[model samples]
Target: MDDEPEVVEAELVEDDRLPAIAEDRSPAVLLAEEDPDAWLPPEAEEDVQAGIPKDTSRAYKGDMDRFAEWCETVGRRVMPAAPQTVTAYMSYLKRTPREKTGRPYGPNSMDRIIASIRSSHRAAGFEPPDTMGARKVVAGYREQLALAKDPAAQPRKATPADRRVLHQALARLDRTTLVGKRDAALMLLGHALASRGSELAPLDWPGSFTELPEGGFRVRVYRKKRKKWQNVEVLPDPELEMCTVTAVRDLVEALAREGHTSGPLFMRIDQWGYMGVEMTRNGEPIGDPTGRISVNGASDVVSRSIARTGLPGDWRSHSLRRGFVKSARDAGVDIVDIGRHGGWDDQSKALIGYVDEEDSSGERNPLAQIGKAAMKKRGDGGE
Candidate 1:
C-alpha cells in the first residue's frame, strides 16, 4: 500500500494570490501563487486594496507584522497559529499594559486588534474555526454587551432650560457677518433636519440647494446612513419662514457673491478672512476624521454655544429631534406621519412611545368625566 502524501502550505500570501494545496491525505495545506482559475476583476482588486482607511491599514499591517515576529520567536511558521496559541495571545494582550500609556488595552481596541488578526487569517485563506461556532460566540458577546449597564447612554429628552441656554449661545453671533450667517444657517438646517454631522460636513453649495415654487426651497441631503440622496421640501413656516429664508438666502448670496459657487457650502474661515471652499485635493470635501464630529458635533456646537451664551442646561442637538417629535405630537399629527418625516421605516412602536397617554385622550383627568356624571344624576333625580 502506498503511503498518503503530506500537504505543505506556505506561511504568507499576498493580495490576489492563492496558496497551493497539496493533493495528499495528510491535511496540511500549502500556500501557492495566483491561480488563473480564481481571478478577481481589476476593479474588485482595486477596491479591496482601498477598502480600509490608510490609518486602519497601517495598524492592521503592524499587528500582522508583530504576530509574525512572535511566531519567529516561537520557531513556528506564521501560517498556522493553533487555536490554543491564538487564545494564549488574546490573554496576553488582555494582561499586558502599554509601556507608554501604562494602561491595559481598552475593550474596543482589543476587539479591533482581534478583528484585524481574523482578517489576516482570512487573507491567507486559513481555515481557523467552524463558522457556526464563531457566530454563536459573537452573538453571545453582543448579548452580554446589551445587558451591561452603560452610564453614558443618551437621555430620552432634553430639558427646556437647555434649549434656552443653547439659543442664547447662538444669539451671540452677528448674522450680518459672513461667518455668522453661515453658522446660523448651519445651526438651523442641522436642527431642522436632525442630520448627522457627517451629512452636513460635506455640504455642497449650488449643487445641494435650489429655489422652489411657492416661495419655498428644496434642499438635497446626501444621507450617509442610507447611502442615497434625499430631497427635502422646506416649506415656509408662517412663524419663522421669513428669518429662515433670509438666513439661507444670505448663505447662498455669500457663496455666489464672491464668484465661488462650486465648493463646500460651509468653508472654514480663519481670522485673516481668506475665503475659499473647503475640499481635499481629490475634490472631496474635508470630512471629520473622528466620526464624533458628525454625530456629536451638533451637540458640541450647541453646548459650546450655550456655554458662550451663558445659558442653563436644557438645549442640545438631540433636543431638536426630540422637540420636533414633541411638537408634532402636540399638533395632533399621527405618529406614523412623524416617523416618516423622521426617516424611520418601522416606527409603529416608536411612534406609540412618543404619544403621552395623558395628552392623547384626557381620560386621565378625574374632572373630565365628572360633568357627564353630574348631568346623569340630575336627569335621574327629575325622573
Candidate 2:
C-alpha cells in the first residue's frame, strides 16, 4: 500500500502549481490538474484499467460529471462552489421530489451528494472553501429542522417490537424452494453478520468461503471502508442453531448445492440454476460487480417480509444491527463484550451510550429495608 517516493514527489511537484495559501489556513480553490491515471498506485492502476470488480472509478467519474453539469448550470467552476450555492442545491433537492419515485431527497442523500462533490474536488488536487465548511452548515440545518415543529423533522427509530414483527414475517417465508431458500438465507446472513449492502452484494462463492470442520467455514471479507487487507475468519456457530456463522454458511451451501461456485452469491435466479439480471444487453447479465447491492434491493427484501406479516413500524436493514445490540444488552451481556463481538473498538464508550436509562436506574436503586435499617442504627430509640 506504500506509494513510491518518486510518485509522491511528482504529485507534490504538481500540487505546487496551485495557488499558495496561508500555512495555517485550508485552501479554498481546488485545482483539477493531476491526471486521474496518475492518481492510483501501480497495482490499483492495473485493477482500474482491467475493470476489476469494486473499482469505484466509474462512480467517481459519474460524480465528477454530475458536479461539472451542476457547476455549468450555476455559472460556477468546479473548483469553487460557494457555501450558499451548496446550501441552495441541498434545498432544491429537498423540495424537488424525485421524478419517478416522487420522494424528496433527505438529509442523508444530500450529505452523500455533497460528500461526493467534496471527494471529487480533493481527488483533483483542489481545496474548496465550502467543502471544508459544509458539514458544519449541514449540522446547523439539521438543528433548525429539528426545532421547526414539523412532524417530518423528527425521525423515528425502529423499535424492538418492530424488529420482532420483521423476524416473524421473514420466518413465514418458505425456504423449500430455491428462491425462497436464497431469500431466507440472504436475510438471515445479512442480519446475523450485520453486514452492509455492498459487503453482501458482490459475494462470490468458492472464492470467499472455505469449508471448515465442526460445521463451520472460513469466510473472507473485503472491507471497502478500511481500504486495506482482507479479513479472513472462521465462523464457529453451529449450522443447525441458526447462529451468525451458521446462517451465512447455510446461504453459501444453498448456492453451492445449485452448482454455483464462481459468481455473485446473491443473484436473480432463473431455471436450471442459472442466475439472471434485471437488465442485460446481448444476453450477458450485467451484474453490479461493484460489490454493492442497491439500497432498493435491501429495502425491498426487508419491507416485503414486513408487509407479508403486517409488521408494525418501519423495518430496514439497520434494524438487524440494532436488534442484535439491544438483544445482547437485555441478555445480560456486558456492553464491552457485545461491542467486541460487533467489531467495535471503543466498546466501553459505545456501551455507555447504548445502555437504556431504565437499565442503569435499576442498578442504582437501593434496597428500602437496608437503607432504613442503616439510617436508624446507632443513635436511635434505644440510645
Candidate 3:
C-alpha cells in the first residue's frame, strides 16, 4: 500500500545548571537570548540561526540564562564577560555537584558549558573571551580525574545491536500487534538508517521515506549535528526476520488503517494498542496530530524491545546506529561510505574510534597476523 505524501518541518545534555531564571527577569535579555533575530541584524540572523539546531539553540540559551543568574549573584558581567569571570564560572561549575548524580560535572560537560558561555558572548556581538586559562583548568581536572579512574571521565558506548541480537529481538516481537509492529519498525529502520533518537523522533510518514524503484527506501533525515538534511539509502533486506523496508511498510499500512495517514512516522501507542490522543477543551478527542515519540521514548522502545528477547546487554537507541557501523564494516563497506550513511563527519574522531576499536584485536590486528605466521611456522616445524 502506498502511503502517499504529506510534508512537515521539524543534545547530549546531562548536567543540571543553576536554577531557572525568575519570570520577573528582564524580558529584553530573555528575548535576545532565546531569539537571535531579536538582537541580530536581519541579514546576519538567518545564516547564524540556520547554523545551529533548535535543540542546541535552546540548550545554549538555558546555559546562558543560568550564566546570567550566576553573573547576577556575583555581580559580574554576563555578556562581554571577562576571561577572569569565565574562569571563575568554570571553577564554580567544577565544585558544584549535579542534582541527579550528586557528582561533579563530567569533562565533556565542562567543555560544553564553556562553549555555551562563548556562544552567549558571540550572540551578543561581543568578542569571545580567551578561555585558554579556563580550558586549562578543565584539561588539568580531566587528567587528574582520569588518574583517579573516575567513571565520570570515561567515555561510555552503547553495546552495538549486532545481527545476532537484532534477529533475536525481532523474532520475539509480535508483528500482529500495533505496539509490536511499531517496535519492529523502529528498530529495523533505526539500524538501517543509522539514526540518532533525535533524528528518528521527528520523522513524518510518506514524506520522510521515499520508495525507490530498485527496492528499499531513501530516507531524508535532518541530521541535527550537521544542521542539514541528508538523504540516506537503505538497501532491501532479504532476511525476513530483519527486513527494515518490510517492517516500515507494514507499520505504515497498519497506521494508515487506524486513520493516521500523516504526522510522525513513529508515535506513541497507548496501552490498549490504540494510537495516542490529546483531548481539546470541549472534551473532543483529537488524535496526536503532531506528537512524535520522544528521544528518550524511542530509546526506551529499543531497550524494552531487546529486553523481551532476554538478550544480556545494555542496549539503547544508539546501539542500532552503532551496530550499523559494525555491521557495514564487517560487510567490507568503506569507512567513508559508512560515515556518509551514518551522518558522521568525514574523519570524525568518534567514527574513527569505532573503527579502531573494531580492529584492535583478532585478524584485524597486525600482531595477530604475525602470530598466525608464527603458528604456521611452528606447525611446519620451521621454528
Residue-by-residue lDDT tens digits, candidate 1, 1-383: 00111111112233422222233411122333333344345576566655544345555666667666655676554544555555545555555777978855444444455555566666555565223433334344444445675321222334322223335655787767776776666666655554545565566767877888878667788654345677776666565522455667787788677666675676654345445424365766664432212434445454555556664554555455454566566676777776766555553554455454545456435576786688798899943
Note the Cα lDDT for every prediction shown. 0.53, 0.52, 0.75
Q: How many backbone clashes does candidate 2 have?
A: 3
Instruction: Tell me the tens digit of each residue's lDDT in model 2 across 292-347.
Output: 24544654566566667775655665455455566666677777766655445552
> Which candidate number has the best TM-score?
3
For all predictions, the C-alpha RMSD in Å is: 11.3, 9.0, 7.2
The reply for model 2, stretches above 4 Å from the true place, is: 1-67, 82-84, 87-104, 131-137, 149-167, 202-214, 228-257, 261-267, 270-284, 288-299, 313-316, 347-383
TM-scores, one per candidate = 0.57, 0.62, 0.79
319-382: candidate 3 lDDT, tens digit per residue: 8887888888878799999998888898787788666465556766889989899999999999
Residue 141 Cα positional deviation in candidate 1, in Å, after optimal superposition: 10
Among all windows of ten consecutive residues in candidate 2, which has the lowest summed lDDT? Answer: 1-10
Off by over 4 Å in 1: 1-41, 48-103, 127-166, 238-244, 277-339, 342-383
TM-score result, candidate 3: 0.79
